[model samples]
Target: MRIKYSIPIVFFVALVIIEKENNIISRVSDKLALKQTPQTLVQPSRPASARPKANVSVTSQGKRSSDFMLMKRRLEDYSDYRPAAAAAAAVTSRRKDILLLATTRTGSSFVGEFFNQQGNNMFYLFEPLWHVEKMLTLDTGGTNATAAAKAYRDVLQKLFLCDFSLLESFIDPLPVDHVTASLFRRGSSSSLCGEAVCSPFVKGVFERYHCGNRRCGPLNLTLASETCREKEHRAIKSVRVRQLETLRPLAEDPRLDLKFIQLVRDPRAVLASRMVAFAAKYKNWKQWAADGDVHVDDDEVKKLRSNCNNIRMSAEMGLRQPAWLRGRYMLVRYEDVARFPMRKASQMYKFTGVPFTPQVKAWILKSTQASKEAGGIYSTQKNSTEQVEKWRFKLPFKIVQVVQKVCGPTLKLFGYKFVTSEEMLTDKSISLIEDIL
Candidate 1:
């Protein structure tokens, strides 16, 4: 009698367990089927407006559970998917940044000013890395090109990000004197903070720039990220950056649309111009010093050769640029642009996708007019054919010969030939014989 009772109890318990298992499986299957089915999978019996929406929920131990809670959690935790939408938006709406990579005293400011004056569409930065040059003394002489390039690129990256912290730190407390003033003021364009009106957040930085007292401040300025993002173009002119390879990382970044306008000037003219400026700024070439000794070295000759090397390095780097940067990296001659402002300005504007409006044309004409000064360290003459050809008269024969000997190959590479006599060639010629050459 006892064994018979035990067998019946065991069978009853097993039957109840199986019933619960079947119920659970049925509920799970129904939930999955509903999820996998489209709206057309079933016809509504009632009018569409009156039909009840499908809902799936399960009750276990007095708690309701969602069929896709695990999936929802996984989706929420996966951060990588978020950037896809952001990146797509960035690709469509991001502004293009143009870099005017040039040597010192090459009239880069004049070019930069052209872009800046294009209304709200453009933001221009002038020599943001002159601070870097100051940091790297002449003794260092950019011996480690890679490190120098990296530092220059880093500064540029910061500038593009609209972070003026690095730039502000480099600002000297010195007043905007005749020599150091124009860099702080870029024609009629908006200030670094935008229109020169600074938001409370960036006010301190702008104040530190001493732009208010210096007359470098513009009437309008903003620290709004949207304002920067909304601009169609941003341009930076840097004389400190010598090699284009330094900017490779930035050019390759999908986050940025980086283009280089490698501006070249006549090396002879550059040498002569630099000499005049150096004499005026530094005062008294009578007491020049370099390399820890008071050796009598020609400042113009040293500067020309240095500028030539920089030009060559940049050209070599431009040639090696990845296939992605063909049209983006441009080589514009100052002579060409200065000679025909309307045409060259139009070409440059088109390249950067900025419309060459009537206002822009007028600015170009007025800025390059014979009576107006190009300002900054630029010559006082108009940006005319005369300005391009003026080097012939301004530079002495001996200085011209020295510059040609040093920079002739680069000049020829860029389609500039020496028309002067060969007899003037000297033993002091600075030849282009670097590894890249």
Candidate 2:
């Protein structure tokens, strides 16, 4: 075969290959693997001015690809780092809220405004859900529990929104979501309630509560979750605030923990104030039932009498109050509240997570003193001797005896002494208390 190879045959083969390359020149070049003399390798063209800036630099520490992807996903799902920043903003801005609790005519009006002044972070809610709970209980009582709940919640929403104009008719509606859709709904300020710190989102919840915006606010509280839960439930259900169980719902709210300050007054003084307030509001005793619409059952009448006697008795026993009330709820005597309103209010601040600032003390003195100076609201009128026991003197002896008889035991239980800065004699008050107990 080697001897037989011909130059003409080789020329024919080369000519065939050249013809194939001509058919597809681009692909044919890639296919060729030969290294020949004059083969060109062109350099990439660029502007000479291109250079890395001195200020800009890049550093690299290689992490495993899989680990990085996992971390990126985690960061997306739950990035809690931002909450701290948000809370810092809320605290600095002095935008936040606190729960208020007081029965009717217990100086709620002034008290509400008073708290608003001292608390840089505190927001005022003037009877949010005011009497709506009682009203719903009236309509839905033992009937349709769901309807009652809905009505109660509607009222609560209206209260939060401060839409009192439509409130009268709004509470009677059913299907809350429907009401939500039709009405200018203001969302709840639930989330910011118990959070250890405040945030813009939480602040928004408070801000939107007044005008109209339907949304659930974010809350980041350090309290038990139950407190917020129950508070929302009660707000929806329209439970009366006076009921002891009301505290259960409020305290248990995952959002709120109870730092209760149970403010109490001498029942005698309270009764006197009541009588005076009643007289001011009404014309005479007959109006108590007729115009004022005050009603008394056999049990309530008996209980009222019992309350007075027990109080009187307790006052005689000792000045040191019972441990039951003191520990369970900080006992703030009305007398103490009146005497050093600022100092006592500061005590409340320490308890209720409200900051006890000097400004708070100043605020209490200013607000409370103004009312006292007015000398109209439950005034203890001054006498020539600077001590007017006119109430003690003018109040019928029979009424005193009756009050002593009923509330005397409770008085000792409360740690009060029944006397007028006089002689210490037989403790009839104690004996009376013992009889009742």
Candidate 3:
């Protein structure tokens, strides 16, 4: 009986030892697998209570004395390292350039400002390609247009590469327009200025523009500073490039990580806004035309027509793009952004890998105020839904008819229904137009 009991005890002891050894091997394998994973994804989860509390009791010497407290502090020290490493990784890996591609009167300026006002991390250039457009004086088709398109791509490449020195060779002081000049002036404020205002960078723009006085110097200085090297994100808003294909090379370039946000607005709304702005800017349209050719295309009507067609073409290009190509190009509508500012802004920030900081949120709220207070067609200060449907009232029935005829299909493609003449004759139409005007 004693021998039988001894044999069973020995067998049980051996089984226990083997089980413990197996557990040890399993633990070792798990540790090895954990080590192989990228540090960014290796954050270990713990209970909330496990975190070190500052309010916990301390010893006479000010050190945490309790075992739980001591363990908590140690865990926190280890935990703290992860976020720092993660932030550094994010900083090194985030996108470098964002291009807001749109045609005229699509609220590109507003979108540009939205990107720019995010914080110091973001540097924005409003229509850097407008400089190129001014230089070429070319139309948007044929071999000349192709050459011009190449030049535009080249100039943008230089900007993305952060080499403003090249602007000295080709670009000059852009004529001080009220809209852009005001934006440049805002650069004087602490919230908007970038490194270009300081030494080394400022010299490049001054030399490029041959800026003799402060007349338009600040504007050029801001532009030069905003595009300088070493920023988390850099952006430029362009109305000059009518088609997305023109920017395909820049988007595909390996040397630069580029993102394109195709900002669009309802064609009818854009037309009405463009006409209103043109009328406001040039009080005497006939005299303005007689004085000089205002645009490559002559009359305001012609300009509006060309602009609507450009919007249509841009939409077609975006709609037909392949899935892989779509990753580089994101389409944003002015109506959606204006109607749902916070949500749309968040989407934009998320898409660009930009953090939605408190400062950016505050600026978005403050900037969306209507032009009524500031008194300009270019003012995007208003954050109201009113702007989204303003074209319904402001655009004349004939102009609406023309836009609906040309852009109806594209509008439907984007989910906007075409309005019929019978609908325009409704009492709601006349009253809505009168109330806003």
Question: For each candidate, how many residue pairs have backbone atoms clashing (under 3 Å)?
Answer: 6, 38, 8
The global C-alpha lDDT for each of the candidates, from Candidate 1 onward, is 0.57, 0.37, 0.57
Poorest stretch of ten by lDDT in candidate 2: 36-45
TM-score of 1: 0.62
Q: Give each prediction's root-mean-square deviation over alpha carbons.
A: 22.2, 29.8, 19.1
Give the per-residue lDDT digits (tens) of candidate 3, residues 1-437.
Answer: 99989999999999999999999999999997787452222122334355333334444214222222332242223342344335535766665678888877877777777776777777666666655656667464223567667877887888777665444345444334211222322432332344355233333344333222232333443355444554667777777776666677786787776767788777777766766776665343334334533332345545455455555455445443333344454567776677667877876766565677888788878777645565367665764666766767665555565566545434544445556674753335342211100
Greater lDDT among 1 and 2 belongs to 1
lDDT per residue for candidate 2 within 243-315, as digits (tens), equals 2222333333333333334444445444544556666632432244334344344444465653443322222
**Colliding residue pairs in candidate 1:** 194-220, 194-221, 195-220, 196-220, 197-220, 197-221
- Runs off by more than 4 Å, candidate 3: 1-92, 138-144, 173-192, 195-227, 280-309, 320-326, 422-437
TM-score of every model? Answer: 0.62, 0.43, 0.62
Candidate 1: stretches off by over 4 Å: 1-93, 138-146, 172-189, 193-227, 280-303, 319-321, 372-383, 422-437
